[model samples]
Target chain A: MWHELARPEIWVPWLLGMAFGILVGSTPGLTATMAVAILLPVTFHLPAMAGLAVILGVSFTAIFAGDIPATLLRIPGTPASAAATLDAYELQRQGHGAPVLLTNLFCSAIGGLVGVGLLALLAPQLARWALRFSSFEYFWLGVFGLSLSAVLTPGQAWKGMAAAALGVLASTVGWDEVAAVERYTWGRTELFGGLGFIPAMIGLFGLAEVFRSASHRLARRPDARLEIRSASSRALRTVLAHPRLILQSSLLGTLIGALPGAGADVAAWVSYGLAKRLSRRAQQFGQGCWEGVVAPTSANNAAVAGAWIPALVFGIPGDAVTAIVVGAMLMYNIRPGPNLFHENIHQLHLLLAIAFLTQLFLIPAGMIGILGFRLFIRLPHSLVMSAVVVFCVVGAYAIEQKWFHVMVMFGFGLLGLWFDRHQVPVAPFILGMILQPILELNLRQGLIKSDGRFQAAWERPESLVLMILTLAMILGPAMWHVVRRIVAGIARPRTSESSP
Target chain B: MFSAHPARTDETAAPGSNRGARGGVSEPTWKALEWTVVGCAVALTAWLAGGGRSALVLSPGDPGPWLVPWSAAAILAVLAIGSGIAGLVGRRSVGAPREQETPARPAGRWIVVLLSAGYIVVAPVIGFGVATVVFVVSFLKTTSQRWRWWSAVVAAVALTLYVVVLFEKLLQVPLPRGSIGW
Candidate 1:
């Protein structure tokens, strides 16, 4: 690994990929998935290790660059950065854009390093543990994740749950994954493949923000400038003060990211919710709290590393990005799984080293991005919003070469507008769309394996443990409220009786 | 310089004002809308459930296709109905004030939406590049009175060319092209 890093061949592509990733990511409607897809063909010409390095650099840098837009424009460049928009945009509104950007960069690097360390140290043990998880356990995990996302949203929990239900219904639009039965295509060939998640995401976050800006008539301030030196000092102090949060979010992100279907988006959302739930200053979370920005930013970057664990160890892609990586590996005549560990251990080590080197390169890459994109913050609002609309159209169309997708984008844009007006959170809806198929597939598979007996499915120790945790996650907050009420009632003064 | 405080004159400012005011929907109306949403969900699930084996398609060991969707819809319906009722009862008990509503700003939003829809419809006919130029210039001019025609034209031309060159020429992702190839 050390020898590989010393070579210019390894580091040069990493640097160039990082630079390209930042440009693609900071643009609204352009996603990490699109970046990887666009660059994957180019990597085919390079050596396998160098190709892997470029992909790693792109994925890592793109996730961080997403925060740039989320903070500056209240638009999440990628789904993973959606949570960052909650507080990061608020901080930006409070004239803390420089600090927020700086914090995002620093914590993202720290989180990536921590994730790489965990991937290096604990891959085997964690893979073994993950193997113990059956479909029943996954079902519970999916429900728990979806429920937490719905309930932890800032406004009415029921509204969020309703939106999630709608999203799940949307997910069921195509043929069933297991049954091969056409469910809700309504006889249209385009509907057979179902709604593309990227198009829907582009519509919901990107186009919706355009509509919002139009209504509010938001104008960019020409005088706004990034104060990097002063903001960097303040951001450094803020991050240093919360050492525990940094560590906890990183670990949690790694764990969630290691789940086969769960990716950085889920890791970021779950970590952000957990931070808000556990923090002493919870009320300040959506009101520009630095902890809010730190948790998700760190978790998302760490998740990039965590995603590599399953991809290398078990040939299971942790997320969409790794799914693409698996394809790239196959193209290079290198297969993943246990046999690869023995036959191509050197490549595995190279992959790990590339992941670490990408983090090392993030510092310079992120600084360049922050400095370069500051000019974007000062651009006229009309011009910026106009560009966003154009990108949204192109991005949605580029996902699949069909005009139907552009229509889907427009339809979801209207839905998103309604959601925004009603104060319903969009994150849970996206989570539902992502997790619904997985949950349903696992549920049916578990039932099949258990001979259609619920008891049999629950008999496994892992299943029972996950079931208990799901129950606790669902009911624990209500129970705490009850307990607090009881304590308050008992502690009431006797003068209350006389007054009554 | 002390003087008697002026009497409050806003009727909606008084306690227990339930009527729709300042563009805000009344409490009962809001509750009705919630119930309507719940009702639609229940009706859709019921319709789906009525299809039974034909629509659901259960295999030898599978739990069936409609099971998860039906169950999720049922749960959502129950939660929505429960929340609607609870909101009504809670509002009565707490005497919560009606929410203030923002003044309607529908024209700009509607124009943008209409322009976007038109752009999509026209893109296939006139080409994506030409339609984009029209949409950008029209959208900017419609949304803001301060926008100069030359500025809008310049922005529209630059953006269309950039997207066409990057996506079409470089990435080789085929974009919609009409009679005029470029």
Candidate 2:
């Protein structure tokens, strides 16, 4: 894999791409999708490996870059950074700020390696057959992912589902992108862009958190001055302690990422939820537990790698970022689809190598980014909170320089406060918003083609599997108790009879 | 379907038991809050869903943009209503109230939220830069005992300058200039 990349032309663009990924991804309102799109024009003159190096480099690093803000500030720098905000921020506030981020960075790199490794080993098999998914399969895929919201909630499944439905409703504020039909915008031009995602996110995760943490006790917290000294060794030791967790999260992230319409955000949530469900220390989740920090960090970056699978194999984007990458590939005359492997097997292999090696650069690049932010965290607690508010205002405003977006941020901030007070899990609400477009688009398309038969969602083999999974998710808890009771009842009688 | 309020005393109530309800209103309060939020969502979605059909309605089955939201609203309403009924009867949260460890100041949270909301409302009118300075100074002076008013003013000015330089000069974002300007 290293043999072909000896040329400067390849590695230079790769480094540039990773840098751009860090810039856009760490900055609020900018996205990894934007970074790749910006670099697409430059890839035209580059070699296939070089072009892939840039695109793949940006996606992988951008996913991790979001964690910088997520860990240091309570705000998620990117949508995928939502899960990272949970444990990393908790750990940061616990005076393990420097170490948690470094560990998270390593986990991201490890996750990237796992993703690229799987991509190399499984791409041929997956691309050849498993990607025969269509609208029917996609509609089910959307539902399947949506069902995972149940897993996301620590409370009732119904609450999660309702919250998710609310998220879908929030997404409905704008015009239907495909149909171009006006929705609940109510003649307001500002509403056409829908509720600004960045504003809503900053409100829900960032400002809402700021408000919740507004205690006088919080005003006098210690900075990470001493922790920065031992950050390196601590991070190394922490990453070393969690091989099984890292592997599980990465694998889960890769598989979810490989699914079209599901991206790093969903993968992170599902991975976190799965880890929580399986952990003996599940009670420690969201309270600065290392598993909480590791699971989503590893998963989100792995998801970046996973997203390339459907894009390279099925000509369908695995997420928003891959949609741009697919376009960039086509611009370089690298057509993707069923015939992609047959046409350019060597090119594909080189691209995978570039992606795999992209993880190596993530460490130095991510360390520098976090260390830079570490300086900002040295400020007193009051000043840091003030700075956060300033940044949130600017970030929300910088999106479109519109006060309406700022208002949207404030409105969602209020809502988030209310949700926090009321004990509603806002995580599902975000998932719903992200998945609504994919779910509705595919469902409507499937129905229109299948003549409005509700059963059309499960007509395909893939759809059938997803349908079964969704049902299992919804019904699994109820059935589990019944089975346990029945077995206990049978065993009680047998034991008594034998004893007598 | 249930409350997400913090567990009362970590008394370790059994699942589905009303021990939380007996101890405090945390159980009923949460259920009330859940259905209320869901109820509001139902109203908003139902209202929007009714109006979702634009001129792009292709057919009866293909309700165009109306279907997704309308269906979501219907489902939410059903779930909330059903859950409300269940709450009225007997069902409740499955676990103990979540334990909350973060030290909370009821007053401080409101202060931060009010100051932030005020900043948002006044930024465009008062110029983003100036509004930020006032907001930061006021917040620091009011909230933190470490900084006196004069020191708070100094820090606020410095912070505001950094924001202006970063956004307006370096990044070249055209920030709003109110009557006070720069």
Residue B53 displacement in candidate 2 (angstroms): 5.9
Tens-digit lDDT track of model 2 for A1-500: 57778789888888888876886577543456545544554455567678888888888888898887677556576778899898887777766777887888999999999998887778788667745777777667666656665454556677778777887888788867666677777788889879955577667765776676675353211233434447889988998998999999999999998875567888999999999999999999999899998999999999888878866775555665675566557657887765788788888878877887789989988876665544543456677677767777776777667889888888887887777655676757765776676678778888877777888777777889888988897789879979999999999999999995
Off by over 4 Å in 1: A1-104, A119-123, A219-355, A483-500, B1-39, B42-46, B49-58, B90-106, B179-182
Task: Put down candidate 2 lDDT per residue, B113-153, tens digits, no spaces.
Answer: 89998998888888988899999997887667788888888
Worst 10 residues of 1 chain A by lDDT: A215-224
TM-score of each: 0.74, 0.70
For candidate 1, the TM-score of chain A alone versus the native chain A is 0.69
Best by DockQ: 2
Question: Which 10 consecutive residues of model 2 chain A have the lowest summed lDDT?
Answer: A218-227
Chain B TM-score by candidate, in order shown: 0.68, 0.71
Please write out the lDDT profile of model 1 over residues A152-251, one tens digit for every residue.
5556666667777777777777777677777667688898888866677767766776776566534233233666688889889988988899999999
TM-score of chain B of 1: 0.68
Q: After superposing candidate 2, which stretches have Cα over 4 Å from the reference?
A: A1-108, A119-131, A152-155, A177-181, A219-358, A365-377, A489-500, B1-34, B37-41, B44-56, B59-61, B86-96
